[model samples]
Target: MQSTVNYLWHTDDLLGQGATASVYKARNKKSGELVAVKVFNTASYLRPHEVQVREFEVLRKLNHQNIVKLFAVEETGGSRQKVLVMEYCSSGSLLSVLESPENAFGLPEEEFLVVLRCVVAGMNHLRENGIVHRDIKPGNIMRLMGEEGQSIYKLTDFGAARELDDDEKFVSVYGTEEYLHPDMYERAVLRKPQQKTFGVTVDLWSIGVTLYHAATGSLPFIPFGGPRRNKEMMYRITTEKPAGAIAGAQRRENGPLEWSYSLPVTCRLSVGLQTQLVPILANILEVEQAKCWGFDQFFAETSDILQRVVVHVFSLSQAVLHHVYIHAHNTIAIFLEAVYEQTQVAPQHQEYLFEGHLCILEPSLSAQHIAHTTTSSPLTLLSTASETPKGLAFRDPAQDIPKFFPKVDLQSDYTTSKVRGGAGGSNHKTPQISQKPARLSQRCHTPNVVVGLCLPIPQPCPFSVLPWRFSSVSGTPEIEEVKRVTELKSRLRALAEALSRCSHRITETQLRLSNLSSELLKNRDQVHADRSIQKIQCCLDKMNLIYKQFKKSKMRPGLGYNEEQIHKLDKVNFSRLAKRLLKVFQEKCVQKYQTSLVTHGMWMREVHETRNHLRMVSCSMAAHNTEAQGVQESLSKILDRLSNQLLQDRAKEAQVSPSPAAPYPSPALTDLVFHMQELCNEMKLLAFDLQDNNRIIEGLNTPPSGS
Candidate 1:
């Protein structure tokens, strides 16, 4: 049973709800096109007539990809109430995306940029039309999935908007408290007796707050309590904080206050992006009205970044993201080549898909193939080659073989046996192990041979036919050599076990360190709470002391009044007490400020020490891995020599006999070393992540000294 709106739109699903209107997802009967119908409630009619007409006229006149389109305004069949048919955004609002758990710290860098570009473009359009969207926030901005699955953000919800030029001013207060201008906040939210008019820069303040939220998950100026519950504190933070200093406080019930001055470590934006972006935030978020950046300057700075091509290449094979930045004029070939540099996949072997469509690459197309790609919907890179690409395949160990063994020197052919019947008394010749046991194996089998595995077993030890070597010695040469190889294998196994233990230790240390850091952050919140509570207590004590004196003074015999006079006097007394309380709080909170500064300094030092310890652990793990790799490489060479010798011995021996000897199963030593190096690389990446965290912490902790 679908409900119909305006007799034309069949509505069933609800898109969103607000104080004045509820939006529904509807479809046109004739066209079968989906649309969003904004059905206003009775409360919306209570507004001034001019305000009601302004929203429809503004939406009707504006036309831009970044601004939601107003299709038609009609009256409902039953109630004869006005309903606005608007463009439907399937992806919902940016607010919903930020609410996702993965984005709790903020949007990923690329997605944030997309939000930035769209919002800036939309605002520019609004300004050009002499319209000021007084109530600008994430919820008012809707997202639509564009051609390539790219997200297109459009400014919507023009209910609070009005046509006001740069020179004009708006006295009426409108906007969410957290993102509102301080002047509006003082009169509208705080209910303070002050008259202030807002200029176009008010939108800039909202934009700053909105951008900060999109870049880092939360609002910039948050008090110990929230904006609504403690409006005065919110006002104070917004007005008192300098430009670029984000102030947030956290606490448990009755706990100390923990104040933050900069972006959190959890923010996903990269430093490079932050360097360009922080200044924009600072300029627009300026508390001083005159100092804030206008729309032109904001657009100019953002346009520079938006003009450069930013392509996010997603590797479907490895499930990795590679961010590539290039000029708009660069060709698709250069783009693929850049992807190759990052992924090690050859350009010919790379198959890319954009929005589920196979991209047709032509040298003439230029960079348009990737100029519009975004992180939300990236170019999917797939491998077409069956075998591993060049530079990615394992190296051949034979090429690395040296000319001589550590204890015994051999001929260039890796044989040490001497021939009796030659021009010289004893000419060296590569020998057959069955007829004459190779001197290389004979020397290795001897107890006197000092073969060091750490030093390369450079020459091949072809001990294949040493068992039938016809030696005059008591011990069998084959058995002795086998014993030595078995010993080396045992040592190699022990080294591998040590490496496994080290990896486990590193994992455990990382977990413990992470837990410690979480606890430290929690403690800071408690401290903030305690300081806030202490300031309140001090203010209350002074207020109580003054009230007692006032009560005492009023108790005099001369203090008498009628019922009407007494009531009026009571109101006066309350007013005086309120002003006194405010004064007391202002004077007492100075100590809290000093205390917070000291606490912040201590917290920074602790974080530095923690980061230093993390580095130390990373270095130790790297050294341990280096030692393990050295041992593995040595064993790899020995195993290769042993496997080759056994194969040769069996082949030679099989020619003489009808039966063949059992074959030995050689381990994949090369693969083992490759995996070990991979693990080391993974650990190095973890170390880099920790370093990134430290840099974010430093950025947050070290605010401008003057600030």
Candidate 2:
């Protein structure tokens, strides 16, 4: 071993001694780097060769950030002794720190964080790399002091490390007694001595114990003494309260150890500077691992909080504006067109105005049409044509307007009438009044003067004013119609707004659900992979047990069966039964392993699908929310416009002269308003329902326990 060490290093300084090996601080002559050399005392153990081989195999393959680096191995003359070269840590073991007079009691918060972080990081790294540091304790961890006085921790000692698959029975109890899990002790007591099996969860348990020690400056379960007392304390660790409770109990019994006699004074000073220490410590000391702030839960909670913060930061007002503009524009156009059509106008003029901007038309019309038709003037000619026959006669010049005129001719007969009145006097002069037709013609031809007679004006009918009054009344209905249309539009807009908001919320929730599912799957896959390794290990353990039994039989001459007898026994039916039993057990193990794999795979797939579905739903919800927001804005705008128009219409009605013939208000406007409100309410309810469903789906997608 000395010669082998010489070959790997220039010089070695003895640092510590153990029952099985002597540890030396050495400088690698070839690389000019410091390294620790552990030389095994081969002669001290019963199966030294096997132990050395096992340790070497495990250490060579085990590579983790927290674990000590195994550089090389050397064999001595006659292959009797073996030396292992590893990375050197100058700060020595955690055991040294704990034993120091300045830190004998406990480390403060800041110092504890550093220690815990390093240790957990190392352990997590090991687990990630499929290695378990079965013997984690203060002695196995080395703290390296840097030039700047900062300390770096490294996990050491793989002498007791076993590959997860190695089936060799570890009859000799390993690991520090106080940190051993309860199952280890139980397995040791079983009659058949069932092989001990453990996974990465054991490392976490050790970490919990280590944390307790760091906090209290004493092993959580162990009382001061030697290995024997430590063993008794381990029994209590397995059977008693959690690590924190144990530490607390010990602290109470020992009284407060002073800083000078325990941990460094700087540790306490550093802890006092931080306000978050108390809550952090409480979380770390939680009894239930599930409840503790582990990686899974921490990430999940952080993500949720961040999402909410982001939503709060970004305003959603723009969505509302867009909806309001659209709704108002549409409603106003429709009302204007309806009002224009109600006025008495020529068909051609009505068409012209309909095509023009006199009314807001449907969106599809050409700009040219809008320019031509919209006008405020009423068609008085058409109104008069419909209201009176006299107006129609003027409209049609060829009609009989002369039928109301009288046909009268008075010219030559007037002179005859004068002669008759003076008949008595003219009797004597009648013979002198005779005249010829030619003479009369000549008299008439001398330009006769005709006088025009004015016809008496007809009396005014009471109902003649009705048409004008009706026109005034019609104006009221037009305003009412506009108001109603606006109200309906407003309600529709509100409904849309509500839906949009709900949709947005749903979308966010779905995203969170998806992430949760992914994490859950990853965790399950890890667990399944671990189980596969365990099944193989179990099979090998069964084989080893058989080998040990066979070896025992061979060592006892009387107990051993004769070669001929053994051959005969192998030929017997019992041998076949034994072989069958082995095959069955092997199959059973394989089946169990396969079943677990399949179950986890299916579960992961289901979780992924469910999350994806939830995400889609959330997206839908977000869209709905956006729509709802728009609807709400539109509704508000429409209502405002409707109210304003109604007020204006009422004002216009008040200004118009009221007559008995005035038209009544149209009820369509009121009905439209009522319908719109009902629609808006229904939409709001639908959006709310959608939001609720999305929330429920998100909840379902989250992992029941882990996250």
Model 1 agreement with the true structure over 1-707: per-residue lDDT tens digits: 23354335434477888888889888787777888888888999999899888899999889999999999898777787788889999999998776543354578787988999999899999999999999899998999999998999999999989999988987998888888989898888878887777899999999989988888766887565456666777777677765566554544433444445456544667444665577787788877888888888988988876776667776543334456655688887887777777677798877655554445456556786553666556666656533221111111212211222233111211111111011010001100111111112122112221111011111211112112221232364433544544454444445444444434544454454445445434544544454433443443444334333343444343434463354345334433433443443334333333343343333334333434544454554455445545544554555456456556755666676755433322233233334334433433433343344334333322322321
User: How far out, in Å, is residue 421 in model 2?
Assistant: 99
Candidate 2, residues 386-452, lDDT tens digits: the string is 2211110001111101111121111111111111111211111111111111122112112120000
lDDT for each candidate structure:
0.58, 0.43
Q: What TM-score would every model get versus the actual structure? A: 0.46, 0.35
Worst 10 residues of 2 by lDDT: 314-323
After superposing candidate 2 on the true structure, give the runs of residues whose Cα lies further than 4 Å from its correct spot. Answer: 5-12, 30-32, 43-45, 48-51, 62-65, 77-80, 165-172, 185-197, 222-227, 230-234, 242-707
Best by TM-score: 1
Candidate 1, residue 353: Cα displacement in angstroms equals: 27
The lDDT, on a scale of 0 to 1, for candidate 1 is 0.58
